[model samples]
Each structure stands twice: as structure tokens, then as C-alpha cells.
Target: MNKRLVWPLWNLALAIGLGAFGAHALAGVLDEYGLGVYETARNYHMWMGLAWLILAVAG
Candidate 1:
């Protein structure tokens, strides 16, 4: 695969890992309100990162 593909794949993977960590670890460590914020931020970040990944792959 191209380097572009590899980089985006790596980024996508990192986003997934971070999102999972936030959900699994932060949710319990933080209070409900804080957890909600963390989840929203991480979820958006992951989704935007995925969009970038798709753009990288397509363009």
C-alpha cells in the first residue's frame, strides 16, 4: 500500500484505541458528567479522524 494509506490507517487505528481507552477507563474514573464530556469529545475526535482517513484514502 501507499504511505498515505499506511499513515491514515495508523491514525485511524490510534483513534480507535484512544476512543476505547476513553470509554473503558475514563468513564469509570471520571464522574457521570465528566465521563459524558470525555465520551463526546473522544467520539467526535474519532469520527473526524475517520473522515480524514477516508479523505486520505480517496484522494
Candidate 2:
């Protein structure tokens, strides 16, 4: 793999890992709306991270 490829790959992995962690770790602690907000943030992070990865590889 290229050196430039590493950052996005790590970011994507981090986003997935963190999203999973947030989902489980905050399940009982946060209320429904709060959890929804957290999930939305996670989803945005995941999407943006993947986008960066794709852009990095393509550009």
C-alpha cells in the first residue's frame, strides 16, 4: 500500500471502531434522542472519513 493511503485507512478504521464503541458504551447511559445524536455524529464521521480515503486514493 502507498504511504498516502495509510492515513485514510486508519481514519476509516478509527471511525468504525469509535462508532461501535459509542453505540455500546453509551447505550444505557444516554436517552434516545441523545443516542440518536451520537449515532448521527458517528455516521457523519464514518462517511467523511471514507470520503477522505477515497479522495486521497483517487486524487
Candidate 3:
């Protein structure tokens, strides 16, 4: 694997893991507003990871 891709892949993997954790482990723990916030953060993380991956691949 390319060294440039490692960080991006790790970022994406972590984002995915956190997303799953938030969806499953945190399902009943967080309130509606908190869940919304978590989802927003997760989405941002995922997007940033994707952006990094693209940049790593294209640059």
C-alpha cells in the first residue's frame, strides 16, 4: 500500500468504527439532540476522511 494512503485509510476506518459505535452502542444512551450532534460530527469526519483520501490519491 502507498504510504500516502495510510493516514487517509486510517481516518476513514476510524470514522466508520465510530459511526457504528454511535449507532449501536449509543443508541439508547444519547438524547435526540445529542444523537443529532453525534451524527453531524460523524458525517463531517467521514467527509473529511473521504476528502483526504481523494487528495492523497490525486495529488
Candidate 4:
């Protein structure tokens, strides 16, 4: 595997980990408003992570 490809994969891995953390570890700890904010941010971060992976592979 090319070294350049590692970064995007790492980014994707991080997103997945964070997503799980937000969904599980923080699920009940935060209030509704806080949870909403976390989800919104996580959603965008996940999307960007996906995009990074796609571009890394295709570019």
C-alpha cells in the first residue's frame, strides 16, 4: 500500500471511533440539546471522513 493512502484511512478510522463514542459512551451522559449538537457535528465529520477516503482512493 502507498504511504499517501494511510492518512485518509486513519481519518476514516478516527471518525468511526468517534461516532461510536458519541452514540454509546456519551448517549445518556449529555442532555438532549448537547446530544443534538454532538450528533450534528458527528454527522458532518463522518461525511467529511467518507469524502476523504473516496478522494484518497480515486485521486
User: lDDT of each prediction vs. the true structure?
Assistant: 0.79, 0.88, 0.99, 0.85
In terms of TM-score, which candidate is strongest? 3
Candidate 4 residues lying further than 4 Å off, grouped into runs, are: none
Clashing pairs in 2: none
lDDT of 4 by residue, 1-59 (tens): 97767887888788889889989999889999999998898888888878887888788
RMSD of 1: 1.6
Candidate 3 residue spans exceeding 4 A from truth: none
Worst 10 residues of 3 by lDDT: 25-34
**Candidate 2, 1-59: lDDT as tens digits:** 88878988888898889888888898889999999998898899889888988899889
Candidate 1 residue-wise lDDT, 1-59, digit = tens: 77767766777688788878887878768898987887787678778778877888789
Q: Which candidate gets the maximum lDDT versus the true structure?
A: 3
1-59 per-residue lDDT for model 3 (tens digits): 99999999999999999999999999999999999999999999999999999999998
Please give the lDDT score for candidate 4: 0.85
Model 2 scores a C-alpha lDDT of 0.88
What RMSD, rounded to one decimal, does every model reach? 1.6, 1.0, 0.4, 1.3
What is the alpha-carbon RMSD of candidate 3 to the true structure? Answer: 0.4
Candidate that beats the other on lDDT, 1 or 3, i.e. the better one = 3
In order of appearance, the predictions have TM-scores of: 0.73, 0.88, 0.98, 0.81
- How far residue 1's Cα lies from its native spot in candidate 4, in Å, is 1.5
Output the TM-score of candidate 3.
Answer: 0.98
Clashes of each: 0, 0, 0, 0
